[model samples]
Target: MRRHTLSTAVTLCFAASLAAAASAPSEARPASPPASQTARQQARVPVLVDCFFHPEVRPTDFVLACGDGNSRLTSLHWSRWGQASAKAVGVNIVNDCKPYCAAGRFHSYPVVVRLDRAQPWKKRPHLQHYSRMTLEYPAGRPDTFPPTVTYPLWN
Candidate 1:
């Protein structure tokens, strides 16, 4: 009879503790924004960025290598052409850096490119070429580069 009473008391205590725990509230935390909401806030066009001229390939041509293989300027349509200066609307292939940077898919964004005035090449004066290049981005550009980017001849 004593053992049965002791066991009943212990069981009652355990049940009370469980009830107390169940009634208690959990810790509160701030909820983060939804994926679509975040995407909407950052919804802007990508830019034509990281442009340079590899002299070995050709001085007249410029390469837009923006880390990801897809973010590049493949073609340029010149509106004005001159020995000293030139202007063109560049057709660039930009990529959303999703999944991973190296394997991202491509998107198109048109940008204006200008080679304003020729300067003598530091090593080769015979090649009187434009050393200063500017890129005009419409909607967005790299945080590191300005809208009007003046790129060097051999960057």
Candidate 2:
């Protein structure tokens, strides 16, 4: 009888503590924002759109060849990413295509990447995206490529 009473008392105490905790307001809860602040927060910044139409900022890797897996940029370290332009240093991996594209070997070359000419994205007028890309090979480059090359980026 003593054990049964003691167990009942403990259970009742536990239930009361839980109820008190449930009624207490949380101190870590964030306060609601004003209407103007919410609108300002929703405003989009300039970005680089990938082949898949995804907006990216300071991406570590990006595809240069969207049609075939021939070329790409990897190990990117962006020094600047602003409304007008962005710059980075990375490796440009290209396929040699010695025998043929199917039997090609990939090679890596150090490159300096720059993106500029920001304009309103065609798909999303409210957002801006870079429209041009220039790559400069500091040390060595592919046999067919020059020291620098500029290409129009897809919107």
Candidate 3:
């Protein structure tokens, strides 16, 4: 008789639990955004592609002269990196080539770097890259360079 009472009580408790669960509200899930909105959010920022085709953002050092390492940017501090443009301040190290290309002294000049004209990268169409780079020397520029110069970055 005791065993029968205990079994009845256990079954009652189990049935009550099921009933409570059936009446409970379902857990809510966040609604997903529209496909267009998701795509826009996922759009990648423009990057500076290195000579080896590696993308870089806020690089401390970058080689402007990929072939001979004659000119480069060092100690870069980027102020802005946006969809349309990017800006930075760094030192432009230029090889003077006083005697010849093989034997030249590198000179440092204070410069403001601006990257603009963003377009879809040919190598990675889903992403964008800065196509143009303009360098403005604030003071003591390299002898071979003007106060301001612009170059078309390789795609």
Candidate 4:
């Protein structure tokens, strides 16, 4: 009976320790940035750029969020990583285009993406400093568009 009690206690303690380790936060998690309005610096700012779609074949369309607002689109790029990492974000709106409409202007918009060399580079609300974005667009009307994209680092 004494042996049984000792084993049970040890088992309980081990389980508790494992649980604590599982929930602990690590260095990979950075702190959030402060709001500074003096400069055009973006608090939750993403590296953004507008690109034109040059189609070699006919034109195709994808979904997107766009307008005169922040989450809007005007022109599009394929994502520097191409169709494979498109989910990490390949295209975005180009406001430079006057009137904001033209052939191959894209319709299906994917969410924002972080184009980190690492797969699934999710954005953390607490991250400080700027993260780089890789912009890609439909070049040559090329016969491809990424089927998936990641979020936060859209260009």
Candidate 5:
């Protein structure tokens, strides 16, 4: 009986310590790429994000033209979910057509964004950190106006 009680207490303490260690804080800045980006980029390189809600499928194959900003870029290329590692996707998607749009199972946004400054956001202008573009499908079918994939990045 005494051995059983000691074993139980030890197990509980070990589990609690593991949980706390997992939650320790880490530095926010530095390169931050979504797992999918490299895989997809190898198959189909990122070209450009010309405009938001562009009427037609605007190809992003021109992103190289966008130039690397002063800060080193950390690309995030993921689908609606990041759990499954990014594999090359079907379709040569042009995000310019719908940069901020939610349409059939897929929603897209521009991570390389610029913020207007001199006020609320900052005293100076800034680029948004490596961000997300969502592509969701319900039961393997596209979700119209797919809800934004939720991720929290702290600075």
Candidate 6:
């Protein structure tokens, strides 16, 4: 009789445990992502130009936030980067160095940005850098002192 009662109690407890488990919520599973999202993840990543002050994050048509409020590089498209030269087209913004740099008018000039001896950036090994930036302004530039400008990589 004791054995029968013990067996009945065990069976009842086991059944109650299963019922509680069945009533509980199941664990969540992650849903599959959309096809478009997967395609975009596989697409080629764009490269960005190093503007003066701001850190380069991603490729952009305009070179932005150089910290110089009046001047910026824009419409930049880097075509090729060979050992000798890297070709690009953009517009250069030159602020007139007036009584003070702060109170100066800004001007935009069409330019071709060329990079020679392109190499990997020191700080960011993955990113590319040029030994120098040769800006060729086809249109007339503003009448500022030291009109011709070249940006050096190491400096």
List clashing residue pairs in candidate 5.
47-60, 47-61, 47-62, 47-63, 48-60, 48-62, 48-63, 58-94, 105-142, 105-143
TM-score each candidate: 0.47, 0.72, 0.72, 0.21, 0.18, 0.52
Write down the lDDT of every candidate, Cα atoms only. 0.50, 0.78, 0.79, 0.33, 0.27, 0.54
Better of 2 and 5 by TM-score: 2
Error of 1 at 28 (Å): 69
Model 5 alpha-carbon miss at residue 58, Å: 35
- Which portions of model 5 miss their true places by more than 4 Å? 27-155
Please give, for residues 2-100, the per-residue lDDT of candidate 5 as tens digits: 745554555456446545544645453344456476434423322222222111112222221122111111233333221222221322222121322
Instruction: Please give the lDDT score for candidate 2.
Output: 0.78
Residue-wise C-alpha lDDT for candidate 2, range 1-155, written one tens digit per residue = 57455545554554465455446565633454674664353244467888667667788998888655578899999998887789999999997765655455678999999999989889877778889999999999999999999999898
State the TM-score for model 6. Answer: 0.52
Which whole-number lDDT from 0 to 100 does residue 122 have in model 5? 18
Ranking by lDDT: 3, 2, 6, 1, 4, 5
- Per residue, candidate 4 scores C-alpha lDDT tens digits across 1-155 of 57455545554554465455446575534443343541234323222222221111111222233222213332334344332222233334332222232212223334344334323213433222222333344432212335333344332
Worst 10 residues of 6 by lDDT: 51-60
Q: How would you encode candidate 6's per-residue C-alpha lDDT over 1-155 as one tens digit per residue?
A: 57455545554564465456446554432344575763353232222345432223223343333443355677777786455566777777766646445444457888777667655666555445455667777777767524456776452
Q: Is candidate 1 or candidate 3 better by TM-score?
A: 3
Cα lDDT for residue 19, model 6? 54
lDDT of 4: 0.33
